[model samples]
Target: MRKIWDIHGGIHPEENKHQSTGTAIGSIPLPPEIILPLNQHIGAPAEACVSVGDKVLKGQLVAKAQGLFSAGIHASTSGEVIAIEDRVVTHPSGMSAQCIIIKPDGEDRWTQLDACEDYAQLDHDRLVQKIRAAGIVGMGGAGFPTAIKVNPKSNKHVKTLIFNGTECEPYITADDMLMRERADDIVKGVQLIARFMGEVEETLIGIEDNKPEAIAAMQKAAEGTDIEVVVFPTKYPSGGEKQLIQILTGKEVPSGGLPADIGIVVQNVGTALAAYRAVRFGEPLISRVTTVVGETLTTQRNIDVLIGTPLSFVLEQHGFKAEKKQRLIIGGPMMGFAANDFDVPVVKTTNCILAPTQKELPLAPPAQACIRCGMCAEACPASLLPQQLFWYSQAEDHDRLKAHNLFDCIECGACSYVCPSNIPLVQYYRASKGAIKIANAEREKSDKARVRFEFRQERIAKAEAEKEAKRLARKKAAEEAKKLLAEKADSPAAANEKTTSKPGAAAAKPQAADPATQKAKLERALSSAQSRVERAQKALNDEQEEADEARLDSLRARLKQAELKASEAQAKLDEFGKAPEVTVGGEQAIKDKMAMSPRDKLEKNLASLNKRLSTAQERLAEAQANGAATVDALKMGVEKLQQKVNDAEQELAQLGPDSAAQGAAETAPALSAAEQAIEKAKAKAAAQASMSEEEKAAAKLEALKARLEKARARLTKAEEEQDENIDAFRAGVEKLEQKLTELSN
Candidate 1:
C-alpha cells in the first residue's frame, strides 16, 4: 500500500471534464493544409529538410532534430510541400516562426517504418535512439523532449516510474479518455518504459478518484503485470510534475531540481502511449487526442487531431459558433492561454481548445493594490512568499527577488486565481524572471571580456621583461670586452712568462705593438666612424628635416675623422712596421695598400650620396602627388647628390688605370660591406639603362603596387595602435594607390 502525500496549498475548481469524456474518442478528418512549427519543443528549433514543391508521404521526416535536446517533426499526412516560411504558431506570444506547410493529396500514405515487437531484447541505447527518431516529446504541456527526460545521469538511479493519469486540469479530459479507451496500450507503454529503466522497484500509475472508469480500465490492463493503479482524492493541480511526484512518492523535489534528482521519473499517460506506438508499431507522433469543449461547441468530445492542423478547421468541424464565443483558449481554463489568432496550428504540446462563452469563464476584474493579504501565499504549492516577490519585482530589486526564490514559482496561475485583492502576481513574476535572465547573460559576457584583457596584459609584460634581460646581458659582454682590450694596451704581456720565471728575449715583444693588434685597432676605428655616419643619415631621413644644416655639417666632420684615422694608420705602418719596399714584390704591395685606402673612402662617399638621392626622390614624388610646398627643398637635395656622385666618378677616373691593377690584389681580400654595396648598385644601374621602355613601365607598375600594399598594411596597423603618425601613413597609402591607378589605366 502506497501512502499519498499532501502538498502545501491547492484549489478545487469545478472539473467540467464530463462534457468531453462522455463520448468515445473521435477522429478528425484531414484539413486542406497543415502548418507545423519547427520550435515545438523547449530546446533549439528543428531544421527543415523539405522544400516547396517536394512530394512527401505521411509519417515522412520533414524536419530533423537540430540538437540533442530537440525533437524531429514528421508529416501528418501525404502531401506536397507548398511553403516553408514564417507562420502563426501555438505560443502565448502569438508570434510567427518558421513552419512547413503541406497540401494533402488525400491518400494518407505512410513511409517505411522499422518496428520492434520484442523491444526488451534490444539494447537500452538502441531503444532510446528509436524513441528519439520517432519524434516523441512530453505531451503534458511542458513539451520537453521525452528521450532526455527518461535518461537520467549515470550516477543517479530511478527507483520508481510514475504515470500521471490524473488529468487534474479543469475542462481537459484528453488523458482521462485515453486511459479509458487505450488502457492495454498504456500498460504496454508502462512495461516498455520499465524495461528501458532496467532497475525500477515499482511502476505506479496515479489517477484521481473522480474518474472511476479510467482507474478500472487501467487496473484491468495491469492484472498480471507489475503496474499498480493508485487512485487519490481529486485536486485541481494534482497533475503537476512536481506535485504528482510528491503525492505518489512522499518526497519533495528540492527547489530548482527535477523529480529525477530524487530517484524518480514521471511521464504523462499520453506520452507513454505515444512512446509505445513509436517503438512497438513504429508510428511517429503525428497526431494526439485533443478535447474540444466549451459553451460554443455543439459537439463536446475528444478527437484524435493531426498535429499541425489549424484550430479554425477543428473548431469549424465541431459546429463552432463564432458569434457566441467570447474567448478562444488553448489547454485547460486554469493554465491555458487565450488565442487571438485562429489560424495558429496545434503543436505537440497542445491538448485542449476551449471556446467558452463570457459566462462560462468570465474575465478577471481590474487588479487593485495588495491589502496585506496572505491568500496567495496560502495558495502557493511551492511555499513562496508571493506578495514580497510582487513588491520586489515591481521595485526592480533583483537581488531581493532572487533571495525570495523567484524561479521556484511554477507559474501555475494558482496564486492569481486565489488572490483576494485580484493582483496579477504571476504576470509580475514572469517579467522579473525575464529581466533576471538578461542580466545574468550580460554579466557573463563582461566577465569573459575582463579575463581576455588581463591575459593580453600579462603576455606583454612577459615579453618586455625578456627584452630587458637580453639588453642587460649585451651591455655586460661589451663592458667585459672593453676591459680586456684596455688591459692588453696598458701592460706588455709575454706568453713564456707563465712557463718560466724570466721571459725569453723573443717573448719580450709587447702584445699591444703586434701587427695584428694594430690592424684590429684600425678596423674598430673605421667601423665606429661608419656607424656614426649611418645614425646621422637615418635621423635626417626619418625626421624629414631638409633644413637641418647642422646635421649635415656633423656628418661631414665624421667622414673627415674616418679619413684622418686611415691616414694615421698608414703612416704608423710605414714607420714602425716592416717596409714593403724591402723586396721587389714588396714595392707592388705597398702601392696596392696605399691605393686601397682612397678607393674605400670614395666608395663610402658614393654609397651615402646614393642613399640621399633615393630619399630626395621619394620626398619629391610625395610633394608632387599631394601638391605640397616642399618641392624646392627636395629638388635641391637631389641636385647636390648628383654633383657629389659626379665628383666621386671624376676622382676615380683621375686615379690611373694602373691604380685599379695595383689595388685589386690587396683590396679584394679586405673590401668592406659598404664597398660591396657600391659595386652591386653600379651593376643594377647599368642593367636598368639597357632595359626597353615597355619592360621598364611594367617593372615600375609592379614596384608601385607592392609599395601601395605595404603602405596600406602600415596604415591599418597604425590605426589599431592609435599611433601619432597615422595621418602620415594614410597619406602615403593614398599617394601610392593613386600612382598605381594611373599606371594601370
Candidate 2:
C-alpha cells in the first residue's frame, strides 16, 4: 500500500553520501575570538542587547529575542564584546548581517545556567518559556523556532508524531551521528514533546533503511516506550516532511496543509537532540554539529561549532585548502546555495558546509534551448508542469507563472539535474519566486495607501456635506429674521397702536440708550483675537519639542560615554592588574590590531568601555571650540523667542477698557470678513478639484483597467490555442509525469 501511495515525480541523481559520513561528530576547540551573529534563526533577527564593549559570560544572552518568532543569542565564551556591526553571515545570498564579535578574556567563565533533572515536572508553558529564554531553536536545516513548533495545535488534533531521522540528502551526516551517539537522549526528548502534543496515539521514528545501526540503537531506546521505529526505503527527498509522512502513514499533507492538518507532526532527529540539551541541561542551541567535508579538504569530519562561527575558521581547523576547492556549498547539492565567500558564518540552519573539488561536484556548462524533451516535467517532485513554468518565467508572464503554481516549486534542483539542456532551471524558478514575492509586497503596500486615500476622500466628502448644510441653515435663519421684521412694520394694527401710544413723546424722538451693550461687543472681538494668539503659541511649543527630540540622539551618545569613563576609573582602582581595554574611545578596532605603538590616553580610555561607542574621536581643543559656538547659537534663539513674546504682549496691552465695546461694534465687520474668507476657501477648493491626487489616481486606474481588458482579450485568444495543441501536450505531460514518477519510486 505504501509503495502504491508514493506520489509521482522526482529524479534520482548519484548519491555522494560517503564524503562526510565516515566520522562521528566531535567538538572543535574555540577560536581566540568568536563572532556571533544576532540573527542565526529563521525569524526576525535578535536585537542586540549588549553594546560593543560589554563583558559577557558564557551562556548569557548577549542579544535578546526581537519578537515571538525571533530567538535569543547567547555568548559561546566569556568575552568582552569587540564589536557589533556588519559581518559575513550564513545567508545563501552572502550578504552582511549584524554580528557581535567577542574576544575571550581567557577565564571561560559561565553565567550559571539552570539545569533540571525533573524537567517533565515543570508546567508546559514554563517549559516553553525556559526553552525560549535558553535560546533553543530548531537545529534541523529549517532553523525554525523549536519552541514554536513543539506544540501540536489542538485544533488540528495531531494523532501521530513522526521523528524524522531520514538524513537522505547526500554528503551530510550531522543528524545520523547525533542519532547514533545519543539515541537515549533523543528518545527522552521525543517523549517530552509527545506530552506537549497531548495524546499521541502513535509515535514513529523513521530512519532510512541504509542506517541499520541507528535504527537498532533507537529501537533499543524505545523498548519500554510506545515510540515505534520505522525503516523507510533509500530515496532522495523521502525525508521531506510530506514525502516522509506519506512513506510512514500513507497520509498526504494536502497541497497547502501543514503536518498538523493531517493529524501528524514531523520533527528532525537533530532537533530532537537540541530539545534534549535544552530541556535536560538548560542549554541554549549555541552550537550545532556540522558536516564539513568534500574531496578537496585536508580532512573530513563533523565539527560541533558555535552558531555564527565563520566557515573559514572551520576550514582552517580541518586543514582545508580553500583555493583548491572548485565549489563550496552550505548544504546537500540537491538543495543548498553556492558559497562564494568562505567567511560566511554558520547559521542555526546550516547543517553542512561542503567543500567539493571540481572532480567531486563538477560544474555544468552553458545551456542550449530546450528540444521539447519534457524531461524537466518528468523530474519535478511537486508534479508541476516545469516546462510550462519555464515558458511563463522565460516570457516574464507573472500571471501565467502563478497559474502554473510557481510558488509550489521548493527549488530541489531535480529538474535541473534531469534537463538535457543543462539549464539552471532552479535559479530561474528562484528568481521568479523572488519577483512574485516582491510584487506581492508592493501590491500590499499600494493597497494600504489606497485605503488611506479612500478614507481621506470619504472624510472630505462628509465634511463638505456638513459645511453645505450649515451654510443653508444660516441662509434660512437670516431670511426668517428679515420676514419677521417686515411683518411687524407692515401690519396696520401695529402702526396705528404705536402712533396712538406716542402722545407724550415727540414724533422724532425714538432711539436706543445702553452704553454697556456697546461695550460687550468690543470685548468679544478682543477675546477672538486673543484665541488666535494662543493658537500661535501652541504651534511654537510643538516646534520646540521637535527640536528637543532631534537633539536627543547626540545627547544620549555623550551620556553613554560619560558613564563608561566613570566606570573605567573605578575598575582601574579596584584591581591591581587592570583588564585590557575592550574599546578605544567608543569605536571597536575590528579592522586594527593593537601592538608596538605607544597607546594614547584616549585609546586607553576607549578600551575599558562597556558598549561605549563613538562616532569619531575629536580632539579636546576642537570640542571646546564647538561648545563655544553652540552656546552663542542657543543665546540668539532665546533672544528671538523672547522678542516675539514681548511684541505679542504689547499689542494686547494697547487695547483700553473700552476694548470690549469696540470689539462688539466690530462684530458686524468681522462677520463680513468671515463670509469673505469662506468665499475664498470655496473658490480655492473648486480650483483644486481637477488637480487633486485622488483625481490623478482615478485617471491612472481607468487607463490601467483599459489595458487590463486588452490583455484579457489577448490571453483569451492565446488560450484558444490550447485546444489545437493540448491533446499532444496532454499526452506529453502524462508520459513526462510517468517518467518522473518512475524515477521517484
The sequence of per-residue lDDT tens digits that candidate 1 reaches over residues 133-166 is 9999998888999898777789889999999998
TM values, all candidates? 0.67, 0.67
lDDT of 2 by residue, 10-98 (tens): 65667766666677777777776788887787789998889888999888888889888888989888889999989877766778888
Deviation in Å, model 2, residue 238 alpha carbon: 0.9
In terms of TM-score, the best-performing candidate is: 2
Which runs in model 1 stand beyond 4 Å of their true positions? 50-54, 459-745
Candidate 2 C-alpha error for residue 110, in Å:
2.4
After superposition, the stretches of candidate 2 with alpha carbons farther than 4 Å from their true spots are 1-5, 465-510, 513-745
lDDT of 1: 0.83
lDDT of each: 0.83, 0.72
Worst 10 residues of 2 by lDDT: 610-619
Q: What is the TM-score (0 to 1) of candidate 2?
A: 0.67
